[model samples]
Target: MSSAQNLAEKPKYKRVVLKLSGEVLRCSETGDPISWDTLRKICNQVKEIHQLGVQVCIVIGGGNIFRGLSGSTDQGVDRTTGDYMGMLSTVINGLAFMECLEKMGVQTRVQTSIPMNQVAEPFILRRAIRHLEKNRVVIFVAGTGNPYFSTDTTAALRASEIEAEVIMKATKVDGIYDKDPMKFDDAVRYDKLSYIDALQQRLNILDSTAFSLCMDNEVPILVFSLNDSDSIKRAIVGEDVGTLVS
Candidate 1:
């Protein structure tokens, strides 16, 4: 069936920011940082969401390639310098992801916090919004271009700047669990939670700084696993697929 036909189901939000884990680029337990097969699958999912007529923005993590905070402790790299390296990793990830998306015939634009004009346009709020208006997927990368800031916080910041309806965090786990689902088979999954409840309960799905930004802005977030091929489509199509935090 055509993607348009498949996503004929209603979309809950008109505009959203999809937060991708760096693992999305990892092929497997032992594979290249960017696995073509996995990337193609992810591109296909994003295409379906675009076809649904909902505006799409994305913030992808860089843990698959490098992590700034880890380098400080493990490699004894200067914390500031390591964070900058980590930011660069995100740009590379964006480039690789863009290549796959273009191959799928999707129109996209990569906007970086730390502008490398030759590679991608600088992060321009109005320009990014215009791209979304034109149905072009905009990828916001480079993790706020600052040390000590995480991609999770970047997602929240970008979502607020773009006035996105919600932040859709794509995780490997199905949804927020009372405990680590993998470690405890009896862990309970939360279907719905208020922002205050999430904070009070100390849910680890979103970092405190990032979570606070969403709470302050009144942006709802949906956390769902990306393991299934149709999870993106299902979540945006208003299906009960993940934990909803409002």
Candidate 2:
């Protein structure tokens, strides 16, 4: 059977939550501001899924602009304060993504966990649902408006709240591996795994809090490489292109 046929045969999830790290927005070589090339690539992928009539919601991270917690120890800033700064960074990313999606002629809305009336609407579950119903891609930012919560956790929370069928985690790595695939050439890539196995092995796939949330809520997560052309489309269409962690 063809790959696309295999993908079409898998069970289809009605709606999904996608989590994107901020670093993916930046240039891989320079690690600078949002790369237009990368943004366009992602936009194309999202557009493909949008065309597929899938209800999509996105949670973007802020490591590219500023990873506050990572720098807190060196800068002597409180962890909470640093985390808030990280949240703000996500807003910036949301705006950037909104602009790109708009340029692509795709309707999008940026909603933040924290209120920013002038910039974006505060996250309201009902309103977000409305947007999705209207075929508008919703971009959720600000990481739950709380310190210490990563975007991954936010993804899980939002997915559960919205009753999404699955959460799609876009990462640098193609799938979840037994070890750091980049460092360990012999690492094994898993096609499917239980949340318990990931936790027991300490796979470093999703953050502990995020993993716990998914486990408790029974929300399946698919980890895949964002750089792969048409990955988001393939994922939304039920393709087995990544590690499925349930």
Candidate 3:
């Protein structure tokens, strides 16, 4: 069979947790945070996946607007305060995603680990499941509602809670490589990596806590480039489009 035919195979995942870094919303040329064009591109792709009958849950980071560790810390903000600020950034980002998805006519909800009654619903396991059951995309926000926990860990925790089949980690890079792909031209990308190898090699594709949660829960992770249009859809369809870490 042809490669295109192979790519057209039926989807294998019924439900998934999509982890998107806030950097995905940035404009490369102008370096403006929260580019509407970028946001729309991602939302459109998400709508496509939603139409395929997959229960979509998104976990977005705040690195683009504010990171707890960097920028804030370097500017005299203490770690705890900086992290809280970062969490707020994620809420803002989650609202942005909810707006974009709703505008596309995709049913959506923003559930925050940190409760903000006026802005979003609290993260309740049963409620989140019901939202998915009703075909509404759930956007998890606020980074576990705790300081020191990365958004990556939040994605893992929520995926486990939501009973998602897999965690689809979207990044700018095509996939996980042995070395920094941008700096090292000879860096090799792996098609599949065992959890043990990933840990032992210190792949750093995901935070250790997040990786551990997935390892303990036996939840597979697909690391792929968001630059590839329809990449999330392709991952759900079981295409060999990214590095699979399991």
Candidate 4:
């Protein structure tokens, strides 16, 4: 088969936004903020799909380093200041991811919503699109360049701006469950969910604002487990790998 034909058979979406939580990079065993082993595995999966010709954009959270809301309530940090600190943390994760991806021979660009001229390019919609068109992975960091917004919202916004076909969220659980699966063995997983149902039920797979943005944009969300070695590749190939929220 021609290379194009082979690639066509593999990816369901031409472009996608991958949302990752910073906690995924944490070393659970050592209490370290970033785990090279975990990062490497995730990057390899990203490389796998990129090789299949999928245009990938990434938005990762900073919860592993700090959470703004929690900092405000728990540590008495001012909300705006706490949020800015959190945003900086995401930039750190983005830089680490960019370095790893480039080392793997995959071209990548780190675009920040906030200007960090020395480390990354300021996000420009046209430039980001051009990078994807040229097959360079683009990692969007710094969370909307404002406080009072979650990384989830940033992912939804970037996905809509880039016209990504889907937002693939790598989570701890394999799919969205009625209850916390880790806590409740009887928790039921939904293979699919409608945005309305998810909202009415108050499912916390994403923040309400993020969910609403995606609903309005009509972009599907795929929630899958990062623990699964091949989950990302399976999702990209349109396999039944996780819960589908539309």
Shift in Å, residue 22, candidate 4: 0.2
In Å, residue 221's CA in model 1 sits off its true spot by 1.1
User: What Cα-based lDDT does every candidate model obtain?
Assistant: 0.90, 0.89, 0.91, 0.94
lDDT preference between candidates 2 and 4, better one: 4
TM-score of each: 0.95, 0.93, 0.95, 0.96
Runs in model 2 deviating more than 4 A are: 1-11
Q: Write model 1 residue lDDT over 1-246, tens digit each, in one string.
A: 887866567687889999998878887867778887888899899998898788999899888888899989999999999999889988988887788888888899999999788999999999999999999999988889899999999999999999999999999898999889999999999999999888788889788889999999988899999999999999998888989999
Q: Residue-wise lDDT of candidate 4 within 61-111, one digit each (tens)? A: 999999999999999999999999999999999999999999999999999
In model 1, which regions exceed 4 Å deviation? 1-8
Error of 2 at 245 (Å): 0.9
- Candidate 2 residue 25 Cα shift, in angstroms, is 1.2
Worst 10 residues of 2 by lDDT: 5-14
> Candidate 4's error at 246, in angstroms?
0.8
Candidate 3 segments whose C-alpha is farther than 4 A from its true place = 1-9
The sequence of per-residue lDDT tens digits that candidate 2 reaches over residues 1-246 is 898775574547668898999988888787686888898898888877887778889899998888878968878878999999999999999998899999988899999989999999999999999999999999999999999889989999999999999999999889999898899999999999998898889888778898899999999999998878988887777677889998
State residue 181's C-alpha deviation in candidate 3, in Å. Answer: 1.2
How does candidate 3 fare on TM-score? 0.95
